[model samples]
Target: MNPAVTPHQQIRATHDAETVRVYQAFSDEIADAALARGTFVSPPFKMERMTWIKPSFLWMMYRAGWGLKDEGQRRILAIDITREGFDWALTNSCPSHPGEAMGKEDWAKVKDASPVRIQWDPERDLFLQPMGYRTIQIGLGKDAVRRYVSQWIRRISEVTPLAHEIHNLVRQGRLLEAKEKLPVERPLS
Candidate 1:
């Protein structure tokens, strides 16, 4: 079993003791699996009074889950694994969002370059690069895609109810309705 599989789906797993225990168990399971698969373990995490763990990163890792990328450039192909899927990479690594590698100026360029499209380039065996953008390829397939989409569906399910309610309110588009819900203001001294 992939430790990347969420504890929520692990039916046998429980989190009654400590949040860290659940995270630790999950991380250990994933680390073992990653080692077995010969994937590169990320740089050791640094945190105060913490041993190789940080809550925010754990949350990000949880969100990313587990993924695989079959083909890519030297750096990307060296490992067939990722903590998340293609779209996650596209959106998160596209320079539009903050990530490990991309800086803000680069991200601004990508955002402004929006609707940047890609066409499969046989020579590259990957998506063609968008002009004025530095990223070349991004995607996942087979088991990785299926799992990532499944995780996406589950996450969307969890958030959709409240989102739908908000959408309905926005569709109504009434100032008075929004005004009623607005926080009361207090004068500052």
Candidate 2:
């Protein structure tokens, strides 16, 4: 069952039509940048504009790449980025507490599984949906939250332009400008 999500939460979760388009446009721009930077690679799936991506989704992605030691002091697992298998990985054993730091292998495994999606690429007049789950995991402890915040900053840095645009919109009090730009008539499916 779907729990009641707060308005703020809803805003964070759901992306309106225009927002989806914006993200797609940004993704294409990123792809182009990646190509220019020699980071471009062919991917499967058709990308589409996203209506919204939930915070939980972002949390899940972050958790997958996070390096946490288990009780046995083994290797930390990572979330597999492939379209197959479980979405997370572990290094050693799960940690008893959040104080210990994760090692390189643990971070790589999870970072490799980071989920990135492209909603609608207006440049191509096409939609793309790249696979790989991007999410952050919220833990029960205060320390865990702190770590999550730190991790969140790093992840957001991956999409600097989009992040900056969002921040600017909020700072300029223009986030609601979309309401006026979109047509009032219901869109046809």
- Displacement of residue 5 (Cα, Å) in model 2 is 4.3
For residues 1-189, write the lDDT of model 2, one tens digit per residue: 122321111212222332211111124444444334332223311223211222332222222221122222111111111111111111212322222377767755644443332122111100112223222211113332222222321112133333334334545767575224322222111
Model 2 compared with the native: what TM-score? 0.24
Top of the candidates by lDDT:
1
lDDT by residue for model 1 over 1-189, one digit each (tens)?
223432221111111221111112123333444345443233321111121111121121222221111111001111222233323434533322555688887767865554322222111001111222111223233333343324422111012222233334545875366434322221111
Off by over 4 Å in 2: 1-80, 83-135, 138-158, 177-189
Candidate 1 lowest-lDDT run of ten: 69-78
Off by over 4 Å in 1: 1-140, 146-157, 174-189
Could you estimate the TM-score for every candidate? Answer: 0.20, 0.24
What C-alpha lDDT does candidate 1 achieve relative to the native structure? 0.27
